[model samples]
Target: MSRIGGQLASRGCPHQVKGTTMTTQRETGTAAPHRVLILGAGYAGMAAVIQLAARTKGCEDMQVTLVNPQERFTERLRLHISATGQQVAEMNIPELLEGTDARFVRGWVTAVDADAKIVRIDDNRVLHYDTLVYGLGSVADTVTVPGVEEHAYTLNTAQDAEVLAERLARLDRGTVVVGGSGLTGVESAAEIAERYPGLNVVLLGRQEPGAAMSPKPKAYLQAALTRLGVQVRSGIEVVKVLPDSVELAGGESVAADVVLWTSGTRVSPLAAAAGLTVDEHGRIVTDATLRSVSHPDVYAVGDAAAIRQGFGVMHGTCQGGMPTGVHAAVSIVRALDGGQPKPFRFGYYHTPVSLGRHDAVVQFTHPDDSPRRVYLTGRVAARYKETVTASPWPTYGRMKKMPASGRYQRETYVGPWLPEPILTVGDTADDITNAESVSTAMLVVLETLSPLERAVFVLKEVFDFSHAEIAQAVERSETAVRQAAHRAREHVRARRPRFTADRSRQRDVTERFLAAATGGDINTLMELLSPDVTLWTDGGGKVRQALRPVVGAQTVAAWFAAIGKVTYQGVEPADMNAELVEINGGPGMVFSGLERIIATVTFDFDADGRITTIHNIANPDKLQAIAGGITRDVGTI
Candidate 1:
């Protein structure tokens, strides 16, 4: 028996392995062990590895191998930042596969033998496998754009980013034109504006900037670019590129020193060269399970696979990479076990854009391109974006350890039920307190109540309902609910401290909170959060989240700190206005400005003057009325 045959025999199969071809016996009592080989180490490839490893962890009958040229995973999304002189930490592939049983091979895959199930590498070695996963992400498509190949800088690799960053730092003053107004181009231009304020950044696009995004985000992006002194030129097509300037189709010349090309991406040449069914752009054509239509054993994902519409073919971006990887992995696992293949599904509800440092715009859209009701801008949205990006790795790490039952076996999960009528004053406990705080902040404000007064007043007046509702929901409340709500409000309004020790005295706490959260300042944020502060995000479970509440200032602070490390170029925090108003019964803050109310942070303070509860309202539907009224007012202004 050959190496492949022997491995299969161990899994109770009698198959003959001749080079890369497998010959099965007619009367075999078992099936051969499926061998899966994956290419690339980017998001899609890495995700495939994790899913496959988890699926075949304890199974000895399957073999999986991941091949990539690089040993580390490069965060493609943060390449713009690296190109603009911001240093980013490398995410190690080995670290990502800590306890996984997947094998990693470092080599450049030059050719694919799809029929023979063999991959030829640069080292002249052939790797034989039963199934192949093609996830060669993408490369800069600079060939079509004339002089762009020789002169323009690209944001494809880490080395490229470093080179561009050095060039940008040395330049004194000139127009830096970005040839692409898509997400990457807009993001790059925004980042450059923030870092090198002296340089004139111009963005050129064929369509209006942010055309694919919602109107709310489009407006916010335009405003943010203007605020950052970025000139946006839309409906312009580049005809010729010179050393000193770029000539448009109408023969208009724009003076430029540095030109960044982030317009488009093309599939790897390996796909077409391998004789697989490929699209015009050289992307391999894959089916619903991410398997190549030309070859059942061959799979393609990420930017390399051209999936048809209506069958869950996601084009580009990390959003598409994850699902493709998962599907490919599941396909491989099912093939190995001789089980039915599961169809691939892509889940995405919102597209988030980071504006430079602390600002962000999130646009929610339905699957059919229709605009959804949710649209968030400014600091609150920025924070939400940061939290989302950092959650996957940690969650993935934990999921690897869960039992087959899919629940934490250490403890039995209990549904929320009324235990007893405990007298809870205000929302002192972490869960109920945070929920109440957010509710208050969103409901309070009419001018009259100070920030603290507004928070307390709203919590007592609005949410202090029947004992059954309170007890069943929060697991506490009934005995002293009314008194607690009333006293919490009174305590906050009566003693108004000029400043909280958690925030810097020089800047207003609310302003700084908004600024830091938007700007991605995890350190400053940690300092601002009270010891018992809790950050609650209400995305209605439509988006990615922690699911559970993030408690304690240190823990929440650490989470934000991680966000600060992944610098999104253009996102920045905007000032939020707290108009004093009456809601429910008492006063609360009505966070509004820059067109609408992004969020309202309400607080419930303890008798000792420390903030015991804080709530952040991010549910767009819940705040629609307030936002609509504020938008109308801003339009009048």
Candidate 2:
């Protein structure tokens, strides 16, 4: 086991794996595998799948099966982008599950059996689950209004988005009506207006756009909509959807060539049918642990589960949904290990709304999602929004191996510990965001500061916190907090590294260096590397690698040169797909041989873009995850 894995074992991490006697197929006189059947491959369901699969990797007794309607992962967060004719990355579910024993079944779920624990898929297929995860996420509530089910378009799926995309593409000049003034509606309206400048876009809803946000962010969002040529009509109800327009409750009709509905959500009725205790809205009513109150065997997640907190029942969101999934997976593992499950707790942090590809407004929030005074607007906020909106899919990729360790601050309770921070891959000036407005290089440098100083700087500078709020988090006086923030700012300003070399130039150098190293060209490697460059390899106890850092350009270059001359395990250099990729917001490369993924290399550069640090990851388990992790973004539920 690796050091991290060892820590997991010692700390009693729920994912301790052990082999079992059961096989994959029907065996004579053999016991059946412990089947974990997960329904709906959304953000929550996908999280459960990866957590359960990785935890149960190589265990013969445990079988994790994920059932989704489609094989391709849905980017629910960016359906607006998809609807605008943008091409998002194609993430295949089965390809992601490769090498793991987890099975991906493509079929629509028709029914569920609470007593017998059998799930009927497509009315023709049946699956018996030792444990069932109910995550049939919600769709837009289209049945409430007249003619909406037939007349309105929704960004509920990629297919739905594509339908809208084709419709919009066909319309040369017409008005687009976005029903609802929620974040989704606002975003959709802004995107449509921005994409098709000729099309008149109108946002109609019961409340103002960004109604939930504080006054500042709310105003910014409204202004942004106006800037994008989106007409705002608030406090108006849509009584009916017509063929080419919508009729309002006030007997007013708005001409629209296309109508996109992003109103209230309605979850699947499978849980209610199966005798699970459900809320009035058809969401499964869950206890503190996320298990169904009526059916203890069924754990519900995502929008399907009406999970209650001190504040209220949780709404369907990617942020809260993912944690519930991870918690459920951990709880299930604990249950299997003869331990009681812990209660699930989550807190909302930020609401990022994109006002098109170029601009956005991000509203910071309290645990209850009521907006805080702070918010981000314009291009920087847009980038931050993009990072978060795109982060989930890749975060799922990382979770396939290492269950991200949750670190708690010594300070009192704040926001919930999440899966992982969304760190973008590939370096550039564009990479710096999160209203931290700090560059990756500066962020990296900030990590070296004392915890209090770091917190103060981030809260004051990045989050626009008042001195009083800073004092509360750090348990210090306002004056002390301000002084600490000042000291931290001075420290960072003195040592902040600046990069003038553009990404393209750096990418060229990195790619060429990778080419030279793969081809065993020692001279090229030496020329590219800094004189005092160091090579760090993290084998993670699964493979043999240098335990100590190898320093000096000549020594590091010569070592790689010798290794490249002779391929290991009957694999030639030609078999290695030495492809350039982005890793942790910097350019990186992956070496995949025929038999397995040989290694992954992440680099750090000096201001001039010369190679400084190379993080060559060759861990057996991690290498496999990296193969599929490089691609994909966006998710559902």
Candidate 3:
């Protein structure tokens, strides 16, 4: 018997219908494990392998196998350094797979039969898989321009880099032309010019280097390139590449002894050849969960997949690629557990570009990949780039040690803290005492306070606790408690307004606001909203949401207008039901679809009855408390 078969025999090998792995055992009377074949073993592929192996460590019913052309892990982020003959740390795939449920196979994948769910290795070895992860990654486009494939060198792989390094080492004096002025081209040109001072280095591309960055960082990058004795020629196209030179748009030939092409990328044709749906770029078109739209059993990640987001289809980068792999693994596990996978949402954070060994530039960005004003340059940026480039291996190691539940446990009573709602009798006389303490506006101010200050303030002001008692309750010194209490009191007094809309007027405005937002009427929404309106979406960092407060009437109106046009949580726009209800002793809105509360939107108003602040809580964990609609008599706390 095989090793897994022997183990299954000792355990009686009972059939299970809840898991995808035991499907083979159910169909046949024999024990067979579900095989997962991962292709490429790049940064993204390795993340999937490690996460899946660690998550299913002791499961004899599931088997994972990784196939790649080499046993060494290629650090694509450091490829430019390696291309310059610099040393980088070597990581072995099989060694990393040791002590896990996954095994590594060193071979090139010749073909993939998606219909048969089988893979053909270069040596004619066939492997059957219940699931396949396509992360073969992309290589520099050698087929685009003439003579590029036959004459130019590329940093596509370690071996390719070594070959280029050997050629550069032999040349003592010659012009080295680096094609494409993207980050790769800039880094290559800078590295060559720094390493071979006697050789002339020229960077040629259509767009200037760091053109996407803000003005300051872009200027810094350009100045650094100039200081390195490198010539940069932008706004020109390379029509053809020759062995001795490259032909520009105007029939200008740039003399070169060595040409490193870093222009464009091309994905493997295996996905399209296997009959999987591919986009214009020949990358697998995946659903929101990173699964192939045609074949849900196949998950695609990294440069091999074209994934769409709210902003747009994601570009290939390690920052976004690794998350795709991790999300694929999580989704696969959820499917095996007889549950549907949630949608995947990602936003770009920063872009780090290396100029050379000792210089670099980092541009901070918003979630939509737009450049932020903040940036770093010089050695500080270089160190930052090196740190992030070297982080993937260690991150994988940490993922292996973390429990699956621990990695995704946002529901365990942990999130941005909020005060509990207070229930009041519905039709009673409006004679409640100290009502500001329980008002929605006051709660908004409390949210701005530090956790400790908020706790102390609530205990002392609302509950009538003395300094000693408040200190005991919050586990703080009396002096500290007094200070926090003073600060909180002063902040709330300065910020909180003594005005609120009655329930009837509030409900009218809420109904209008909901209608305008759901109807995509940006003009009406802007009219109803305050000029300085701020929208706060609390997703608990568990779902796609704004990383910062969305401010301004125009921006907030546009955001909601877009939300009105799309389906959410499998609920169609026509099927969604938005109802106005009383929440936290104030009028609010509850969005329901598919018989569950999809989200809750509460508001805080100013004296003029205009909506000043909007709070949208969409975290599933928080929504569970009100899954069943509000009480007919009153809204429960």
lDDT of 2 by residue, 1-637 (tens): 1211122222232332234323423355556667889999998998888888766676666778999999999989899999999899878999888877899999999999899999999999999998899998999999999989999999889999999999999999988999999989998999899999999999999999999988877887898899889999999899999999999997999998899999888988888999888989999999988999998888999999999998899888898888888888878887866678878878888999999998888887888998776566775577678999888877876677555321111123222111121223424344433212323345456767876687678777766878886564334678988899899989887655344446676678888888788778999998888898878675655466777888999998887676567765357756655667654445667666553456667656777777776667675444433543533221100
- Candidate 1, 252-272: lDDT as tens digits: 999999999887888778778
Write the number of the candidate with greater lDDT, choosing between 2 and 3.
Answer: 3
Candidate 3's residue-wise lDDT over 1-637, tens digit each? 0211122112112224355347566467665777788998888898899878866777777788999999999998988889888988899888888878798888999999999999999958998998899999999999989999998999989988999999999998989999999988998999888888899999999999989998878888898899999999999899998989999988988999999999999998999999999999999999988999999889999999999988888999998888888888877766776678888877787899888888888887877899976565665567668889999998887566542321333223333433432222353334323344466667778889976677668767755778886654334578988999999999998877544536566667888888898889999889878899988776666656665788988998898786568988778888787766666656677777665556778777777778887777776545533442223233222
- Worst lDDT 10-window in candidate 1: 415-424
CA lDDT of each prediction against the hidden true structure: 0.62, 0.76, 0.78
52: Cα error in model 3, Å: 0.2
TM-score of every prediction relative to native: 0.61, 0.67, 0.64
Among these predictions, the greatest lDDT belongs to: 3
Residue 624 accuracy (lDDT) in model 2: 38
lDDT ranking, best first: 3, 2, 1
**TM-score, prediction 1:** 0.61
RMSD (CA, angstroms), candidate 1: 19.8
Q: List the residue pairs that clash in candidate 2.
A: 426-585
Model 3 clashing residue pairs (backbone)? none
List runs of model 2 lying over 4 Å from the truth: 1-30, 405-487, 491-637
